[model samples]
Target: MTRADYVMPSNSELEAATPPLWSIEEQRPRISAVDLFCGVGGLTHGLVQGGIRVGAGVDIDPACRYPFESNNSATFIEKDVNELSGADLLQHFAPGDLKLLAGCAPCQPFSTYSRSGRSKKRGLDWQLVLGFGQLVQELKPELVTMENVPQLADHAVFQDFLGHLDGYHVWHSVVECSAIGVPQSRRRLVLLASKLGSDGLRLDTGDYGKRTVRETISELPPIMAGEQHAGDPLHTSSTLSPLNMRRIKASRPGGTWRDWEPELRAACHRKESGASYPSVYGRMEWDAIAPTITTQCFGYGNGRFGHPEQDRAISLREAAMLQTFPADYKFVRSGEKIQFSRLGRLIGNAVPVRLGEVIAKTLTSHVKMIFG
Candidate 1:
């Protein structure tokens, strides 16, 4: 996104500003927000539940437009973030006096797994983060928020983003997402900032006790490999080879391929070096939080993604639920067959909606504390 020219609003201007809490409660002239890099509206849904009046979501993926619109009742624009301007967002707001802008920028660049060849591929995505900083510099919204993998907080790109907050009060932390009620183990770096000075701002952790894998998926109707739950098309599972059938059936929950008999071992696993990754070809523990659900979470061979005892890989819907999306969330149109590649990317890449809710509450409480 090209940077828009802007001047910092002075202290008198800041003091003259009305706290948005009034608009939220009176239900007229509501506080409005915009979400960038929104994927399938997971964070948007949670933000709505947290009480922000979201107006538009910007994402480059056309596939995101449907769910982002359907669930959040917000406009979804298909454009790269680098192409966006502060003016592009102004059109979406209602008659709100205060505005908030937020997003979870694409996180692959900072993910632990993607760290392998970071130097060459970092340009495009790295620019996206810089673009976000540029927008903040221009729009200077009353509030700013974002969710990304934890490693990002360590990078120079993030530090430069921090430098852009010249007069803003910022609260940031690396959070254990499971502790906040997401059913998978995800660690994310969350940043919340406000133009108001840092006096009373804080981000509180949720005390809602742990959510386990069984609590999430034990109730869904069972389906076999390559079969769709007759009632829910999204619950379809991928087919397993005859060899994989035996592999999964022999697999115990939370156990690795190390449990397999010598005859059943894949040639790769039999190699001495392959012993390093014990999580692959394993089943999830029924009573534990699931392993992090990745872009390839639906494929059993990719990780410990096998169904606990079903002798099949976890289905698409299961992966979505594990990511804290509601059971009824739709990724594709009705009567459309589920495409694992596209849909998996949507689910795996989404911010667990619960995480959004936490950010929402944090922002709400902070606003109330400072405004009142």
Candidate 2:
């Protein structure tokens, strides 16, 4: 299969095509939500699926503007979160109506993997979380939700931000993505805060069931290395270097390249400095969930983004599905180019839609118990 095979049909074609397998009518609504830092509307879409009406999504990235609007049918404001005011958000919804403010601030600075040697001197990236705190203080919505890498729990700034919530009841947990039905082993810090007090905000624990890679992507049409699903450009796989392709072929499921013969190893892999980074140049196992998909998911060297059995990186659709986005979720619109940088950022940065559904469900139950 060639790259063209995986290209997604134009947005107009998809819109004019059959509707999604699941419809908005199937969901049960409880509250209105505003998605801040709404990357491709993952949380917003999931909230919609769970019956919450998302009023608006705010983010600075232009790439997210289209997918967020297209998929959620919500207005997208392309602005940095720092620029938003409480009054600006109030216009989206009327007074006396129950409102929820949800955000997943950029996690790079708070991430354990940040390459800045855990130094606080790296200032710019670290300020994004501060911006989120500012908005929370301004909006003072009835309910608040935040999702981020678990590292955020340990950050002093985050602690201070929580303190600022004052009388609001807050419950936070470091949730494993697999436990929430996202077909990845990603762990995130999830928080749900409510002005309704302690009894109103808690997540109910559920049995952790495993979701395998095959269950997530096995049904998609097969394509060769570097090819897109013929019917969906957004489902295309990344091109691989010839040597890397050979290396992937020799790789065992869930095994790192260290399992291969010395000749197959990259030069860095042979160095002492590279010993600690065993997860790079790894292959995913068919029967297990994938490792956390990160911003650099399009790059094979980033982590275990390789196909379980195929000799190429996972496609955009596969990544989105692993993140628990519905298969038919519209990404690029009609006449738009599906650039990997833009698409990958959207997928990598999104809150897993399944995770969002769980959150919305929990919040809905809480609201009903308190104010229904």
Which candidate leads in lDDT?
A: 1
- Candidate 1: regions farther than 4 A off: 1-30, 115-118
Q: Candidate 2 on 95-150: residue-level lDDT in tens? A: 33457999898877766656665566446545777777777788888788898888
Candidate 1 worst ten-residue window by lDDT: 1-10
Report each candidate's C-alpha RMSD, comma-separated, in the order given. 5.5, 10.1
Best by TM-score: 1
Tell me how far the alpha carbon of residue 153 in candidate 1 is from the true structure, in angstroms, after superposition: 1.6
The estimated TM-scores of all candidates read 0.90, 0.87
Task: Write down the lDDT of every candidate, Cα atoms only.
Answer: 0.82, 0.78
Alpha carbon lDDT at 120, candidate 2: 65
TM-score of 2: 0.87
Candidate 2: lDDT of 333?
A: 78
Candidate 1's TM-score reads 0.90
